[model samples]
Target: MRGSFRRYTRWFIAWASLVALGGWLLPPLVNVERYRRRLKSELEQELGRPVDFGAVSVRLLPRPGFSIQNAAIGEAPGFGDEPFARIERIECDVRWRSLWQSRLSFDRLRLEHASFNLVRRPEGGWNLASLIGREAPARGGTAAGSPPADAGGPLRLESEGARLDFKIGADKKPFAVINVAARLDLDFTRGNVNFRLAGEPIRTDMSLPTPGRVELEGEWTPGEKLSGPLAATLRTEGALLYDWIPLLTGRNPDLYGVLDLQADLRGSIYSFQFEGRGTLRQLHRSELPPPADAMPATLYARGQFDARERGRVVVESADASFRDSILHSSGNVEQVFSAPQMDLVVAVEHSRLEDFFQLARRFASGAGAAGLSGRLDGLVTVRGPWREPRLGGFFKAQQPRFIAGGTTFPMSDLDLRVNETGIRLAPVRVMVAPRVELVAEAVFRPPAPPTMRSKQISAPSPPSAGEPHAFGLRGLQYDLALSAKAVPVSDLVRFSRSLGIRAAREVDAQGIATASFGLTGKVWPITPPAWHGQAELRGTRLFLPGLTEPLHLPHARLEISENRIVVDPVTAVIGTSVFTGRLEHQGGRSVPWTFNAHTSQLSLEQSALWFDVLGHRPPLPLLARIPGIRSLLEQRTAASSLFAGLNASGRFSVATLTYPSVTLTNVVASAAVSGRTVQLGVESFRAGGGRGAGDIRVDLTAS
Candidate 1:
């Protein structure tokens, strides 16, 4: 038995050596180049294009394969003379048994350094349509009820360094892909194909960004018509997304970031569904200044598309997060007509407003958003079949606080709602101090037609035609009401200053002031705003800087309008004196004012309010250094348009008056001021039953 085994081993070794030698030496003896023209003709017929090559080599052993070097496939008509496809090298292997049967059945194909240009012609037909055959029934149809054609055996395909170019007419498309390495297993007998592809994204225009990697895997049926019930997954990562945005969206976007994305889908050409997730890290914008704080964000989505129905897309679910804050949404859009129809719903809960600001700070112009801290909850719904979308929603903030210019306002429980006609805020309350509260409510409507334009129409008319009143806020027209409860004067003054109301910041006051105000107007400052309001200030005990005793105003009624303010019958008590006045101010480029005041009884030493406006000093000069006094001095010195630029006139009557060492009865005075000059007349005065009158004038052009 040993001798027989040794003899068999020697025979096997000799046969293997002979086969190896034949595989290496047969190609040179056979003149394989002679068959190149024939092979090229066959390929041209199959590909529907002219084919050319540099060299062709045949291998007899090792499973019977051939190598073609430097092959090119010509383009279709009107697509220029450049080759549509080119390959540095290609190898194909066939089964030995197939060769024995005199059949040319390929088992495997490999391509290296291959490039293919896929183009869509100007008339909207693809260049490769001929190779794909007609989608309609063939001319010589098979008999009805005949068995299906037999699909060929499996073919393994491998490609390395492959590139695909997309073109419209003669111009390269914006986006392309290169450096593709792929592996495909096609089972024709089973009508199934499985493939893995990976590549780098490229831009046809060299100026565009080319900084991303993509990978994909899929399984599908490859029938004569290539109908699909396919499944696929894709992944991509990019370091600078803005560079590539123009290629995809044709817009120069301002965003910059590192982004990673992944998606999975299962469907067909007629209908499809997909889910995707993405992360954006180190995100910022080139146009915005660097943020003091920034955070990464994540987004998730799932959707379906139906090509049979106008290619509508329905987003079944979507979730996005900034830090711990999250927003969930769903929507559908269909372009079935010239105008699209859409419906969407968005809900946000447990979202941290501070974290959201961190993401929004780049777009906030480096203003007040960074100083906000709170949580938000909201629900929004939008529906549209007509031109204007209808919107309904509400957003509420809990324990929100914002700091600006070194002052903090704790705004609490703000609810903003949108209805059919306008946006509404029921009431938003803020704590101005330890025991002070400010509450406000508003309803903002859509913009109204210009009065002058609307006046030309005789009858009441609808809004201008062809101008759509779309959803969201267009131009803000609002009605507002505000009230304060037990607010301290000092705290209120500070709060008013923060709101750009500097006039109230310099008054020295004590105790609490209760106030109410209302306004109706458009919000844009460039347009004249309508104003209608009545504000009442009831001071428990208000003090002036140069006064020894505090004053009390029991009633002060003010009426406000777009161009005027009127204060009538104001009554105040200072020491034992009583005073009343009516003051009217007209708003214009130059303010014009009139005052008619009467005093039933007055004590000169107790009326500090009158003396305070003159930059007067109290008995103690140190009082001038107080906050209210200093602020008043600063404001007075800073004002370039004071009484000098004002047009004002006033008349006063006093029943009885007491000065430092004199007493007067039934005194009357009148004053006029215009453009840096003042004129005063003492109409009548009675002292110890004697009567007297005088007039005075002063020019104040310099000071």
Candidate 2:
């Protein structure tokens, strides 16, 4: 019995040894092709989509592994065409035991090149939604739950070298590119995914297909639902502004700005905190289409944003300073975003208004050259889920000065409020002199249509004159009030001189004036139309030094019509000269204004004084103390207050201001307007000792 047991034991030992030797000599065994088919089947079942592969290979070396060449996972059609991301090649180093543990341990995943089409659907959904077997429900359906089962555990992927292309819309134009050759360290256990893309400069193209060199290093965690704090630094070079300019203005912008950006962001999906700084060097505008000139070089900006809540985003601070230029701005803004609602408040300190005007003139016309220097405070609010946003705000500027058309008007304070209706200005006080104060309140609407033209012309809205219900005008409505006290009219003349506007002569005079009116105008919807109420001007001690002698106009009541002006009983030293006039505007290449004025009971002495003050002095006699007046003052008599019924017709154009042409026909010293021309008969008058009277025909058109 002992011998038989020994034999059996020896046989068992020998068989066990043979089995151990067989395991040691053979490699780690794995059905790689079977695993690949299983993976494909599992992905199809999980994603509810077909999966295809160009080639599948398995390796049984140190550990079981597999590789797929040109693998494609199908996506929904309506979402986008190129939904399946085709990887050039994929090699994964995976641990088989870990797969049973509901985990994947991949030593590395070498992906050569791939393209992903990330599309934002018209209904505001994502194309990637179907990849995880999660389809967004129709409008009325209940919200979807968490991620679907069989979604496959986190993938521990480390890319060797790869290129990624992204497209949007139907055209499938490449909007973004990511040339990635990075070392990705992923730990599914800790829910940490850290990656660093380092190579011969990872590049991308956005907006204009211009290559932008970029470098990225970041860490992310998916199990934490991106809630874990993340740190990344991205460097981008050769970013162009002209590429995105067309988005702002339908036309291609002539802007040229290169970008050098550095960003540091750390945040979660719920709330984010970021601080970034970028420099724009060599900023220039080569050729603007119209109404815009080339701009100066400007330094970019640096700013920070922090969001603590879901709906609130705060601009911790931001600053943009100009280089070798006059513009400088630093501000802080806060924004609240809620469903169908948004509100923003901005406060700018040490803002230059002149620089602001320069920026504005690029898109608008009739913008005067006025520099602004002060603190700017503004608040804007938008409400509702409407297609067009409704906005309202209030902007205030302190101590703003305006320099336009040769005039300098220093405004003490300017405050404007914008509502659903239009823009209204608070009472503004202007300082023209030490004691002079000009207070004004106004509302300005935009110009009507037909004033501006674009490539596509739109029809104007029908007039509302016959179908008015409650509103006044369709576009803009305004009411203005202006008052002045102790203002020197001579200062107006001085201001005009600076504006290059011709002034007869400078005069020193003080007066108090007040006017109130209302204006209604349409925006540039179709045609520019405006209607203004009458304005009344009252002045006292208004002196005119341009005359041969100082003259005072105590009071004047002027009525202005569309094409006519009637001054009723003007209180003047000229024995109350009353005048009525009509003006006609001539359009086209020349801006000519035609006027006809009839005057009566005009004092010759006063008229002569005006001419002398205007610097249009007649020839002076050698023996006379007063220049040019020796012969004029010598005139005799009780008839000194001549019934000089003067009918004057003349046309004045801006081009003819330098060399004026004048023609006076059928002039009578004491006559009235009998026809188209003034019927005036010259009367004899002596200045000092000379007397002369003759029919004089003055030709004003002859230069």
lDDT of 2 by residue, 92-182 (tens): 6665665675534445556667655566554344454443323333344422332122332444445544555434455453334456566
Q: Assess every candidate by TM-score.
A: 0.57, 0.48
Model 2 TM-score is 0.48
Judge candidate 1 against the unseen true structure and give its global Cα lDDT, from 0 to 1. 0.69
- Candidate 2, RMSD to the unseen true structure: 15.6
The candidate that wins on lDDT is: 1
Tens digits of per-residue lDDT for model 1, 362-473: 5434243226678889998877853457767998888888655567788877788875566677777777777678888786665665663321211122234344445433
lDDT of each: 0.69, 0.47
What would you estimate as the lDDT of candidate 2? 0.47
Query: Residue 68, candidate 2: how far off, in angstroms?
Result: 10
Off-target runs (Cα >4 Å) in candidate 2 are: 1-83, 87-114, 119-192, 196-216, 224-229, 234-261, 268-271, 279-340, 348-366, 374-410, 417-423, 434-437, 444-489, 499-581, 586-703
